[model samples]
Target: MFGRIGRTSVKHPWLTILAWVVAAFALVALAPALKSTTDQADFLPSHYESVQVGKVQERAFPEQDQPASIAVFWRDDNGPLTDGDKADVAKVTESLDKAGFNLVKKIETSPEAVSPNGKIALASVVASVKDPYDEKLLESVKELRKKAAPLLEGTSLKMGLTGSAADALDSQESSGDTDAMIMMATLVLIIVLLGVIFRSPLIALLPVLIIGVVFMVANGLIATAAEVFGLEADASVSAILIVVLFGVGTDYILFLLFRYREALREGQAPKQAMSDAVANVGETIASAAGAVIVAFLALLLSSLGMLRAMGPALAISVAVTLIAALTLVPAIFSLLGEKAFWPSKAWRKQPKHTLGKRIGDLTARRPGVVAGVSGGVLAVLAAGVLTFHPTFDAGSSLPDDLESVVAMEKLQSGFPAGQTDPTWVVLEKTSDGKLEQAEVEAFEKKLAASGFGEVSPGVIGAGGDVAQFAVLLKEKPSSDAAMELVSGKLRDAAHDAAPEGSRALVGGLTAVFADIQTAVNRDYSLVFPIAGLAIMVILGLLLRSVVAPWYLMLAVGLGFGAALGSTVWLFQGLQGKDGLLFTLPVIVYLFVVAIGTDYNILMVARLREEVRRGQNSADAVRHSITHSASTIGAAAIILAGTFGVLLLAKNSMLQQMGFAVAFGILLTAFVMALLLVPAVTKLIGPRAWWPGIKSDTARPAEPGPLLTEAPAGDRASV
Candidate 1:
């Protein structure tokens, strides 16, 4: 199948190129933009209690809504507020309230909103009915900041905004800049690395230009699919898509280009070399991509809508990249031929001393020693996994310098820590009529008296059958303590004490985070096994061996563990952070396990190819590693370097993901794929393909002595 694709692409290069151009352009022009939401409730099914509670609040309390943002004020002199400072804060609040800005529903300030110490005061700004991620809300936040800056100039007091609206505003501004930063970093990484390795400007820039089109095409198709299927993309998918395309896209291209170059040095014509390149490595690339696609599609099993949407979106991207690597990438290189490496001229001469040769010789000569050392490094790092702590504190993850985080800290100093984002307990008379006021008050008292903290008087909902009470805790909303209260003590108290014929539901940011934790834990159990099983199936099919896939996957798994454990050790143990972000494990699995699988597949496939030749298992291991080393090394560095750029992002989650994935890819290439996999293959021999192949006996080596030559007898076909 890949041979035919290569032949057709080579036969009609211009036509193939033209088709891609047209498809990419039309898709870019016609497809709708993808839409995403910031509300955690929006990403969950209605079955979860947090989601159900959100529905009740939306339906029952349409008049007085949750505040979109909160402004905390204090004296700049760092003392108790004087009458003058208090008057200035009141004046600024009144001014902003009367401005009547779009999306600004109302602003509320009262004596009760002031802190008991008289050092701080609070104002709540509510937005009109709209999506939490809506641009209008962000605009209103910006406008509010603009107007308040001048209003507070003459005062002794200062104000800082915190909560959802402020976060949305910050995320919106940063994501745009983040995209640009990632793109620039990715481009520079690719160009510099490719330039250094190939010593050709065309080689450095070709993949960039090619993958840029892939990005446009993938995004357009994904956007179109989202529209057709009503998929809810995560708000950050665009940024992620950027890295995935460049990282994986470059990987596939490297697979082909290296083979193409090696074939050229072996004296094959441009067309024949291109054909052989695609034919040889095509299955390996396809299998690697297939593994990733299946893993991503496994997210369909995730209870979280964010993963469901992201899973397919990313699968589409890999599918597009795979096709381009097989068809479009080959066509262009086929046409460029030997001229593609014009200035380098190195393709004509194989260097006598190469690192690939050295590593290959070491592995081939001392398989046991190499495997032992590589496996030991992973085992030591994997020890850190036992100490992993998942951080639920969103505020803590935000840069400490961010306004929302800063303002939140200021608010904690003056008010009940959780008051900035209170948990609302809703009671509904489940059987049908108006809720008895006595029952509602009793429920409120039960919540407050249970030791969680203050509870506001009940506010009747639109229907008399429902009532709402705001509960504030001593812990910050995003803290583990707050989530435990919401998920354990507070929820248990509410459910157990509800009046007859009524039910109590806990809602609010803390409850929502707790519910998110539940969903993620469920995914860890369900999604990981499913994805791992699916990838194993892909490998089994690609390798024609059930045995090879198991240990290959095992190696990849170890690599992922080491990557994750190292991240936890760095951020939590060494840095003394309260915890790493809760969602990082999932990110690491997707990038490290799924993506790192690519390196393993390439190495193992080449090992099998060498075995099919006349060489003994040990020689095959040496020969395969020698030949595949340059390709894997350069690709790993490029992909890892691009992800490493994520460390430059200000967001803690991005930084964690960047480090985990980058380090993981390098570990897979240099350690697992390079040393561990080949060494194990040498030990397992022909039986590793048990039930698939009949013989493991060595064939006599062929006549070729070229440094870059493939093993002698016609290599086995996929």
Candidate 2:
């Protein structure tokens, strides 16, 4: 099947090339702009309490003023705020209100609650719009910042905006930096690694060029898909797309290059070798990509809209990359010919048995020893899984040096921890009659007495119809204890304490994050099993052995456990973090299980190829390792290193994700792929290919003669 594909592609290389070019241009031109939402509430399912609360608030309190940004002010000289300072703050507030910036509702300056040390004051600026994530809101915040600069030019007060919109802008800027670093690192790693492995600038440059084109096309297509489907991807999707396209694309390229070099060593012409390479590696690349795509697509099962959207987008990307690998890659290589290796003559001859061969021989001779040792090392690491915890605090993921974070900490010390951003208990009239002042007062008193630290009532509906109370909890809003208290006790209290004709709804960041936890939990059960089953089916088809798929999956499972366990050890045990981020497990599971399987497939495919060529089962394991090791090892290192750049991100989530994935790739490539798999293959012997027992018959050897000195006909083939 692959041979046929290789022949056709080599014969019609221009057609293949032209097709890719045309498709790329069309996709780039026609696709809609990709859209992302920074609103955490949007990520949760409508069924979650947070989402329900949000819906209720939107419907009931349609005209409610939402603070788009807060102006945090502190005495630059570390002195107490005197009457002069208070007057200055008032003037600044009046100036902002008079300026009448777009989207600005009003700026309120209050001296009611000054910091205990008397060094700082707060001014809350509410926007007319409800959605804080609105672009107009961000623009207004920026304008406010610029306007405030000169207003306080000679004052001792230092002021900055610190609220949802400001923080979102900061996060977006940081993410852009993170993306740049990740891309630069990945590009350098791919170039250097491919250059070293192939010793050809053209070969090294080809993937960058091809995948670059793929990225532009893929992103454009994803934008169009998102627009058509009305899907909302996370802000980080672009960064992730870069990594996936390059990482997966490079893997496929290496697979083909390895087989191409092998075909060349057998004396095939450049064009024939290119065809043969595609034919041989195409199935493995496709199957590997199928597993990755299925795993990412499984994210559609996630209750969180963000994950559901990401699943399809990433799946689309890998699918495009897979198509490019089989078509565009081969077409380009066919054109390049021997010139692809021009600078490096290493392709003309085969190196003698080296380091990989010795390792393979060791495993073949003592399979049990190798298996036990490798399994034990992973087991020891897996022990750390017991300590794993999940953190829902998005603030914790940000660097502590940010002004909002610092101000938040200071606010925590001086007042109720939730005061910085209180949950709103929105009371809606269930009946047609207007809500009376008596009912509003009674509800406010009940809420205040319900163990809530602070309850501030805003103006009820005109003529005192419906009322709203901003309730502050005693604990940090995003803390687990706080979320539990709010989601369970506080919610119950609010509903029970509401007036007979009015109902209460709790809506805030903490509530949203807690609901996201519920969504993720639901997804774990659905996405994991579905994705695992899908990959198993792919493996079954590719290997033509049900039994092999089971064991292969088990190996990947162990790799997942080991990766999670190692993260737990590093972050929980050593770093003393409260817990892993809530989303880490799923991220780790997808990358480790899916990408890990890529290495496993490459090794196993080679093992099967060796067995088919008439080597004994043990000899096949050894031969596969010797023949396939360098290619797999080089690819793994580059992929792992590319992921490692995530650690450089200022955000903790990215750092954790970067390290976990990088570690998993190292484990999968070096330990699982190189050691555990070969050792286990040696133990399983012929049963590894059970039901397909061509293992019982010694098959034909390679067409080339075995000896160093070849016969005339053998020389022609070799």
Assess candidate 1 and give its lDDT: 0.83
TM-score to true structure, per model: 0.95, 0.92
**Which ten residues in a row are the worst by lDDT in model 2?**
709-718
Question: What digit string (tens of lDDT, one per residue) describes model 2 on residues 11-33?
Answer: 89999888888888888888777
lDDT of each: 0.83, 0.79
Alpha carbon lDDT of residue 263, candidate 1?
75
Q: How large is the C-alpha RMSD of every model relative to the true structure?
A: 3.3, 4.2
Give the per-residue lDDT of model 1 (tens digit) for 665-686.
8998899988999988877878
- Name the lDDT value of residue 415 in candidate 1: 86
Residue 220, model 1: Cα distance from true site in angstroms: 1.4
Q: List the residue pairs that clash in candidate 2.
A: 2-279
Candidate 1 is scored at a TM of 0.95
